[model samples]
Target chain A: MTALLQVEQLEVVYQRAITAVQGISLVVQPNQIVALLGTNGAGKSTTLRAISGFLGLDDARVTEGAVRFKGERIETLSPQDITRRGIVLVPERDKVFPNLTVAENLIANAPRGMTLAERRRLHELVHQYFPKLAELKGREAGYLSGGERQMLAIAGAIVCGPALLLVDELSLGLAPVAVEELTRRLVEIRRELGIAILLVEQSAAVALEIADHGYVLENGRVVLDGDGPRLKSHPDIQEFYLGGSGERRSYRTVKQYRRSRRWYG
Target chain B: MQLYVNIAVLASIYALIACGYVLIYRVSRVLNLAHGELMMLGSYLLLTTASLFTGHPYLAFAAAALLALVVGALVYLFLLRRMTGEMVLAAVLTTVALGILLRGVMVLIWSASQQYPREALGWANPAIALPGGARISTFALLLILSTAAVYLSLFVFLRFSRWGIRMRAAGQNPLLAAQRGISLHGVYALAWGLSTFTGGLAGMLLAMDSGLDGTMVVIGLKAFPAALVGGLDSLVGALLGSLIIAAAEIFLIHHVDPLLSDVVPFLVLIAMLVIRPWGLLGTKEELDRV
Candidate 1:
């Protein structure tokens, strides 16, 4: 089957001097949950932004390579146009329009054209996934707690009827219980809606638990890629990402640790 | 009673013009310094339309109003669209330049001399005396009525309509709005169109009440302080600010010095800035950005 979304040898440059993402490529099949795992500044967010058509806002651009969605070139489209093509991004920060009431926030999203009944059904679906949102519909989003805001953000994206969802840093600054609940909801959403998700996450344990497939990014390159079970068992992942080793090391070994990992492409 | 009537009339005028400022700023966070010129342009369009549709006064008025809306949208599409991702200061400066250019072009086309549009439209300004011996011109009453109609509709639209909610969404977080498939350009253009539509209405009414002249732009500028005093982003603030400024101007002119009429709004603005920079109904957090 054809991939739902494809990023081929993508190179992103910021302000014409800084190379944030260098020649990295990935794919997402329809209805699949794919996690992009990385540490800080690993070009994970940049890759997602490139696919979501948000690089222009940061004075960054996909200088080389292509982003294709359903066999159409979409690297240069505006964010709204990209969204209309059914790729909705839940960004890392400023995820919701803070001043808008929760109900108004849901109403503000422009879903693909649907009948009145379908719109109502979609609304019901969102409220079903996040029942608390229904109760807080009258409250302004700025007043919502971190977990509630994340739920609202996800709910808003779901309202757009996206075929491919891009979530950046879903578990950041959230309680572990909240993260577990959100991940469960994400799985349920994917199963029910049959939409592909490209989730960028820092926590390997959280992401690997839900992701069907995963890619490990380092220094703007995809250093590793495998199915969920294989990646979860990989030694490097266990030692570095999952805190498998309990023994302490000196500062010199700590500084030279990254060179020791056997990264495979 | 006459002083109260004067205050009401002046307050209505300021409120009508001030909402234009509030609408654009609230959406795009750009201060349209050229709003005065745009308002003047609306009056000038009425003058042109008046002559074109002579003997059809109502048709002329409607056509001019429609033209003002189109002109406002066109301004966004052609000029401001280019400045979207740039600094807010740059966009504001562009408006300043646009204002200067519009002023020069208006003078070149219509000349600097005062022209009466009411005569051109074959309409007469008749004053109706109130019970308390206070007289208000027919256009002044129309201005007050229209201001009420505009504010009422705006509140309803922003509060309940789908597009209105999108506008509020776009204003608060443009990036999130875009991600949800809301076109920023469409929202911004709509804002410009609505702002110019109301501003043009104020200008046309003022022109009809008194007479069209170069001085009409001064009225537009004077309304800016009223908008600032209420808060730049709130519709309620605009109305309240206009009333406060108008009351102070009228009362000070009546009690202190007549010449204080021109400086009253500014004085009130400076004091408001010092005391409560966000204005009465404005969001307090907006103080840092503005």
Candidate 2:
């Protein structure tokens, strides 16, 4: 498969003597879903942000690196330039444009090249992936629930017709069932749209299960990199985190959530 | 008929100046507190150009507008760029200083004279009737035409152009718009350019309606009431606000005591501030930003 986007020794620095990310590099090939897994502050999110160019005010700088998309250096480019060039980012925390309606939000980021018919067809593609979004078309994004908001964020990125999509922390605060559903849809989208994805997640088990390849980051460095199944079975990963499989625990937690919901009612 | 024409002529010029405040303040989210002084500066520039004409009024107006564009660009680059991301206080104060500067320069250049237009006094005498029993003269028709042309072209330009979309985006979220490759400097320059362009035109027209003097700067001050009452964010709101003020001034000149004449704009201003601070047509989201 052709390399859609590639990075080399990317470094992102924050203002206050803190290096948010130091020399991390990854690739997103067409139809590839590469997962970067670590606990909070492992710089996974920072790495993703540097790629998206959401570097906030002050001396936040991409001190050194080359992020090439379609063989052009894009590390120093603006976020909207990156977006316009077809590398879309769905920011963590399910951040959809709050004031805009779901449809307006989608249309705002939508790629502008087609006849009305093709535009509707692309709209149908998003609806197919997150059918629930179709019903909430006219509703303001601020009013969406956690799951629906995530769906909208995903839909917004896809609308850009990006060659590579960066998704940061897809499961942060999401329900277990919702995470599973979102993961399934993500793989489906990678297949259908033929867009490479670089997904950063805090959870190892869920991340490894859906990922074709995984990079295990510890502190500011990559500790392990391998095929998803091999990394999932690695002893070091189990020793530091994951703690054997989390399936049984997630299932119990799902049941507990239902019971709590019932009791609150 | 001539007397009837004079009111309409003056009213349209008032509306044109009022609308400039509406456009920049509404879209750029700056009060443009110096707008009145800028108009005064523009009029003086017009007068200087018109003095060269001796009898050619049209040439004077055109030259004033052209030169005003260069002045607008200079203000945007030198004054406004420094204050771009500054707080409302800084932006407001900068414009206040700009007003003082413009006034200082006007005195330096023109020596504070009360000057009459080169055209003959008989120019105000011609008149034409409207279907509703209102009548207009040549001066009145020209004023109405210019006013209509300014607003209409601005309305269509902003509504239809790609640059207008960028301006809207910049107004909404400057950072995001910048990220989208819109040059913030360019947008500010365009805003100031439009502001000064219309400002010069309005000043030239008003000077034609009456004689030019140093205190003619107050006409721009009066425009604030119009912009404020109409809602700074809505283009049409300025026109509505100005019409109300003009009507109040016209009817009050003889009907109400002259002592209370200046109080009318203030009264309407206070009422809107208390009742509907957003004005007649300002979008609701602007309230939160304020």
Candidate 3:
């Protein structure tokens, strides 16, 4: 079967001089949670932005690759048009309208191809996933806790009825308990809605816990890629990302490990 | 009591005009310096429509209102659209240039004559005496009533309607709004339309009460300081600001010198700026955000 979403050797450039993402490729199958893990400036967020058609705001562009949604080229589409095409992104920051009430934030989403009745039903369904939101429906979103704001962000994206959801930095600024709860909710959302998610994160442990497939990025390139179990146990991921190794490896060995492509091939 | 009634009428006029500034500024962060010119243009359109739709006062008024809405939307579409991603200062300057151009064009067309639209529409500005020994002109009463209706409807619409919520969302964060599948251009165009429509209504009634000429633009300009004093982004602030400035203007003209009428609003504006630059109800963060 064909992939639900595909990014082929995508290259993103900022301000015509800085190339933030260099020839990175990935895919998400139907109902799968695919995690893109990288540290600061590793191009994980850029790749997601490129895929979700959100790079325009930052003067960034996907210069040398194709982002395909269900076999259709969509790299040139506007963000709202991309959303209408069923790929909605829950951005890293400023995720909810601060002044708007919680219920207004949920209803602000212009759902793709959903009737008013269907949209209301979807709102109720999302409220079920986060009952706390229902209770705080009338309260301003600005007054929400960080975890509740994250919940509202995710629920707001869910309101769009997306076929492919792009989540950027799901664990950033979140406590471990909150991250765990969010990851659990994500897994349940994938199972119930059958929506594919391309989750970009720096928290490898949290991401790998629920991701069906995973890729590790370093310096704008995908250095390693595999299924969750395989990548989780890889020594490099375990050492650098998962923080499993206590003893420091020699710098020479680390350089040699990066140069070797035996495991990637 | 008469003085208070006069102040109320003047305040309603300023409030009506100031809300237009608040609307466009809140959405796009553009000052729309041409708003006074646009407001004058609205009354001029009413004049032309009044002549064409002879003996049909209601029809002519409605037509002129609709035309004002289109004119505003067109201004955004043809001119302001290009400035969307430009610097705010440049956008504001563009509006200033547009205002000068509009004033020139209006002078050319109308010959700078003070025309009474009430005569064209065969309406009389009757003086109605209040029980409190105050008198209100017919158009002044309509202006006050229309201002109340506009404010109430705008309050409800912005709070309850889906698109209204979307407009507030867009105003707060344009990027997030676009990501949520909102068409920014559409929201902006709607705001411009509604703003110009309300502004036109104020202009038409004001022209009926007195008359319209280049001086009407000065009143429009005076009302802008009211918007800034109240908070450039808040409609309720505009109302309050208008009342404050109008009270100052009315009291100074009545008690001190009538010539002070032209300078009183700005004096109050300066005072507000010294105390709180963001206006009474405006968000402080908005100062840097703009």
Candidate 4:
């Protein structure tokens, strides 16, 4: 299958200091859930942001490489331009328009210039995916729970009907039940809408559980990239992730590991 | 009745200018201290337009609006675009620079002498008598119509249009708006263009009210009181606040003490800041930002 999105040797630098994501390369196949996992500030977010064209103190001025979305060079495109090309990114920090109502937030940055009926129909699909948002359609987004805000932020991006959806984190500060529900809906969105997804997650277990293909990022490079289950059992992965040298300690019996698994479950 | 009529007339003019300031501030978040200078530039645009040296009156008015539009675009690109500051003080200072540039240009074009746009076309200046026994000039009628036209179209465009949605979203959350694929540059450019157009309308209306003069630039300051009273976040607030400000200004002049006239609007501003803080209809979230 052709890669839906591909980044080759992409490098992002801040001033004289290079947060060198040295020679990192990755591919997101069509309709696949690709997870990027790493420790805090592991350059996983840098790569995602570079791909998304988020122009802040950071941007997509690759020191030496390219990012292609749907076979087009999207490296230096504006965030808005990237969205128009059918790749929408929901950044970290639940960046919802807190003052806008949920329904308004969903439609605020919607694909502009569509017919009214078409826009409304699209709104319906978004509401269908996140019923919690629909229930609070008229309420200010700032009042939403953290999980709900995350869900609404995702809904806002996905409603654009993108070919690929990039999510920063879906389970941060969320209840386990809610996380499971969100993961289920994301899976539903993939299967039901055939949208490819690229996710940046801190939780290796949660990401692998839902992902088809996964990559582990360390510092600023892809340390591991392959099938989820294969990487899950890899020795270095087990050491770095599964608490080095501990044998098959099932999370159900281990309360210490359970803290890392699920909050409610 | 005459006093009430004057109040209404003044309010309408205030609304026209207030809308301009609101738009520029919303997207750029810059006070556009030069906003008054834009108003000054609009008067010049109208003066040159009315001179026509040749064309008809309606043609002149249209021409003036078009010229103001260009001036507005240039201001955004050259003067206001690269302006970024640690706090708003930097942006406000840039606006001050823009204001100085415009005033200098105004003197360059029209000289330091006071002037008014020529009433080349006979369309305005015709007379009308109100049922309240107040005689209103046809110019007042035109001012009322133009103000309504601009405000009504703006209301509809913002409330129901796509660009308006994008513009409003930019004001609410520029970072998130950018994430959704709304070009931040495009948003800023559009705001400047639309708001500058309002400045022209306000200039034309104020010219119609009395006459275009250097002092006429003060209309921008007058709009501040109007905008603040209406809640800077709201387009409707501009109009509502203008009416309140204008009525008070006119009444203070007519009833209480004429010397207290200029003081009235600021007093209202102090009262609102003390009392509602959200103006009449501005949202709590917006007030928090202020």
Per-prediction interface RMSD in Å: 0.8, 4.7, 0.9, 2.4
Descending-TM-score candidate ranking: 3, 1, 4, 2
Q: Candidate 3: deviation at residue B109, Å? A: 2.0
List the candidate 2 regions with Cα displacement exceeding 4 Å.
A1-19, A29-33, A36-45, A62-164, A167-196, A200-265, B1-15, B48-63, B66-70, B116-137, B248-252, B259-261, B288-290
Interface RMSD, model 2, angstroms: 4.7
lDDT of 2 by residue, B1-290 (tens): 44344456546766778776766665467777777778877777777776776577677767788888788878879887887657767887888888888888888888888875535322353567776677765555767898889889887776556566556556665654443335667777888888878877777666666667778777787778877888887778888887777777666765767676567778888888889888887766687544
RMSD, every candidate, angstroms: 1.6, 7.5, 1.5, 5.1
Q: After superposition, how far is residue A149 of candidate 1 from its true place, in Å?
A: 0.8
Question: In candidate 3, residue A8 scores what lDDT?
Answer: 96
- Candidate 3 segments exceeding 4 Å error: A261-265
Taking the tens digit of each residue's C-alpha lDDT, what string does model 1 give over A82-159? Answer: 999999999999999998999999999987676778778889999999999999999999999999999999999988
Name the candidate, 3 or 4, with the larger lDDT value: 3
- For model 2, name the residue pairs that clash: B128-B136
List pairs with backbone clashes in candidate 1: none
DockQ of each: 0.86, 0.16, 0.82, 0.48
Docking class of 4: acceptable
When sorted by lDDT, best at the front, the candidate numbers are 1, 3, 4, 2
What TM-score number comes out for model 4? 0.85
Candidate 4 has a DockQ of 0.48
**Error of model 3, residue B52, in angstroms:** 1.6
